[model samples]
Target: MALVHLKNAGITDPTKIDESKTKAVRLASEKVGKDLYRQIYDITFIEKNGPRIEVITSSEASAQECSMSGVDVFVVSRRLGGP
Candidate 1:
């Protein structure tokens, strides 16, 4: 998967940001199931003025699950040399 730095995303308007969040949630719900979304809430983050997401998880499976569901995630575990 490719990683995108937040600053270069080019979205700054509040309405568009909210729209993106809504679309992300909808896509995730359809692709990953609404029930499972609650299960992974600890690893997900949606912001208003800043980076829209900041997903950090220790589980590769969970990260991949979000990725397949169209949510960007970052896996940081001891196995990957993360503290």
Candidate 2:
């Protein structure tokens, strides 16, 4: 996503910095990057403190949302994995 970040920042009419490296003011006004490695913590949290809770992601839950309404609620976030 470094490329995405740079592409976003380069659009802001950069003077000193490379235009291709920065995004526009509107797009670059705020930046949020994910570390993409939080599934371990999420799974651990659920396993250590289970509340009959089945932590799942959007993609996972999407396949079973309607069927899982009575059981699991899809709270999609940065992390989700394990049994």
Best by TM-score: 1
List, residue by residue over 2-52, the lDDT tens digit for candidate 2.
222323544211122333332212111111223211111111112222222
List per-candidate RMSD values in Å: 12.6, 19.9
For residues 1-83, what per-residue lDDT tens digits would candidate 1 score against the true structure?
A: 21232334532333434444532122222223433442232232345655544334221224336443343545322234546
How well does model 1 score by local distance difference test? 0.35
**How do all models score by TM-score?**
0.18, 0.15
lDDT of 2 at 56: 34
Instruction: Write down the worst ten-residue block by lDDT for model 2.
Output: 36-45
lDDT score for residue 32 of model 2? 23
User: Against the unseen true structure, what C-alpha lDDT does each candidate score?
Assistant: 0.35, 0.24
Q: Which whole-number lDDT from 0 to 100 does residue 31 have in model 2?
A: 16
